[model samples]
Target: MATPGFPPNTLDDEGCPLWISGLADDDPNHSVHVVRGLEPAAALEALGADPRLIQPCELPERKPDGWRASLPAAALGIEPELGDMTLLAGRVGEWTFVYDDAGATFGDVHVLSAAGRIAATSHFSINADASLTYYADGDELAWINVDDLDLETDPAEMPPELRAAFEAAGSVELDYLEPGEPDFDICMRVVSALAGMPWTLDDLRRIPLLVAPSHC
Candidate 1:
């Protein structure tokens, strides 16, 4: 099998982001969306987050725990079932990365595309299901279940980059990895390709993100 451009457990110096490799190790459930041509604040607003409620904060030194604790309880939302619902938006070039720990706003096509074209990847740890979706101009361009590479939407409408990314990811040999581990790497590759470059650990740690409670 040919080696992937970004392999699991590889260091950022070698081109794989820490969060990307860490995600493969933990397989935590989360949703990440990358929007083209929008600032973090604008991205948050396009995702239906209230501009008034958004605040600037750096990414937690390690995990979401630190910065999450700093937000007011009201800003964290009221639903206990949601468990500290917050949306963290940061920028890497023209792409705005939105990280949602316990929200499903990525599924709302209108909200996601309102900012710009978006490339998103989501995982539900409970069901062990993973998805890759793209939206543009308030419409869904493609939706795929990464587990089986099944098209949830019409294949005729799939974007060229998304289709090519899926094909490249699907063809790679991931047998050395345990189930679900490959999905994390694949998701990162697809999103990174869309973003035009890998998001370094430094970029993720130091960027000032717009934080807001998730309405979803």
Candidate 2:
């Protein structure tokens, strides 16, 4: 949702905005959006958000690039439930959300697109606020961004089995942006570690993305 009073924003080094609004809850009616820069109290009034539904956490640091996440109690008449409810924001704004459900992840964060078919699961999702099930594709994307990873670098040093598997593909290459670069890099590193593991389909589908317990 877009609020009327926010100042201009600068995109992160990756050419992406500092924060984003994602459609998370399974219900079609409700959506959670993210805003960067403002404190929670002001954001609530801007969105007419309920005080009870928000789960605010300390931003890793003061990011000129924007680090705050503004999740609220409800959106477009919907509220958080057991299903998807992730939104990355730093403040409030007035662009009310609506969706068609073909949503997927963008810039490493889950995004609810404006149009598409709703599937049994999102096009992509990682272990998140609502659950721990991880996504191999998403995790692999994170690895692409590691500044230090190269073909010569050994994966066995960390989780040998997982790294080895990630490299198993004949043309395996670590060419991509750093995990969580420009934003959520902390979580990006954590999520990146999940790729190339000894996970079965069920395990990848079952385990949530894990980060440092302190962050959780």
Candidate 3:
């Protein structure tokens, strides 16, 4: 995928900001809920952690995990540059999460820099241990890769006009196709690819509806 931009501004019914997602049926064991409005340190503290204590002096080196780019952060477009990126993290029950307001940049989501101006990049993560990262596209348990994967699509499956449209977009924006339409699945791969990861046929059925509506 082009690399996910930012997650939808998903919030709880109380409107307290957080993104709820998982592998199955809101399964807590394999799920993540990213809450906002708190600094990285405070966020960790609230999750039954002591930010000052859970450290190797750098977030990426915490304990046995290089968690600076944990799944939640990467899902939001964060990447770890050197070994000094500031962040906070901890484990609560079966979930181990990290937080940082350094924010991330992809599509429209962004946070401010130390100069108080809009930052060029925000913080996101990658679950390197599992070789998995949650996707911020819509909602679901989608994982993406850090490296590029070769993909090919046969435009012959598309109609003349649709084929032309697909070709015009370099045949990459496949999810731009209307749902329930021919080639829609092929297009979804394009959408997933842009997010800096890819999706599989099995992944499509399980994810929440696409944020982009189908336009024939």
Candidate 4:
């Protein structure tokens, strides 16, 4: 996907500010809606009130029994069952893993970095205690330490394109595609990679809808 330029603007709607847009639906004509803000509850409520406004679907309440069942195994080149692994979050220049029993045994690791540039890399089945691992620089390999601080909950200081993707995805509700689901993982990867890059809204207009890998 290409980068996004200007930030989104709030439109006036019945004395309140709303983010307005025309989204293509199953019908030939597009459907118009008012996107108020970023809260998940509000978004869901709006969809529930007018089902025709968005698509309907359901996602698992939590991570599934097998990691592969919850994520795209082939896309990341990881096995179905990760015996030991770590899930980390990162920001502009830092990251840290959230240790879990599943993560501790599967030895799988997913890394996201927005340091000088946007990059997403992953590794699997490494030694349980390995502190440093090989990362992907395009097709080549680079190394990075795993002990950096976590940045998942940090404020998203995203570039325009990244921010637009977030807004676009957030505006809809897809049940099988929850926040941490594998499909969402790919979305996050794309946004993180496009963050801080120079691009415009017109550029983002051409990005095709990313499909989730079916063989997870």
Off by over 4 Å in 3: 2-33, 51-56, 59-216
User: Sorted by lDDT, highest first, which candidate order results?
Assistant: 1, 3, 2, 4
* Candidate 2 regions with alpha-carbon error over 4 angstroms: 1-9, 12-16, 21-73, 86-216
User: Which lDDT values do the candidates have, in the order given?
Assistant: 0.55, 0.25, 0.27, 0.24
True lDDT of residue 100, candidate 4: 18
Sorting all predicted structures by TM-score, with the top scorer first, yields 1, 3, 4, 2
Q: Which segments of model 1 are wrong by more than 4 Å?
A: 1-4, 7-17, 20-27, 63-83, 115-121, 150-158, 167-185
User: 1-216 in candidate 1: lDDT tens per residue?
Assistant: 232444544333222345543322232355667777778887777777788989876443343442333222223433224454566777877777776655356575456566445555543443556667777877776666656553334333567777655444432345465533344345555665566434455545566667787555
Candidate achieving higher TM-score, 1 or 3: 1
Local error of candidate 1 at 107, Å?
A: 0.6
lDDT of 3 at 54: 37
Candidate 4 structure quality by residue, lDDT tens digits, 60-128: 233334433222122223333433221211112222211111222111211222122223222212232
Candidate 3: count of backbone clashes, pairs at least 3 residues apart or interchain: 28
Between prediction 3 and prediction 4, which has the larger TM-score?
Answer: 3
Best by lDDT: 1
Per-residue C-alpha lDDT of model 2 across residues 169-199, encoded as one tens digit per residue: 2121123533322122222212222221212
Q: Give the higher-lDDT candidate: 1 or 4.
A: 1
If scored against the real structure, what TM-score would every candidate get?
0.68, 0.19, 0.21, 0.20
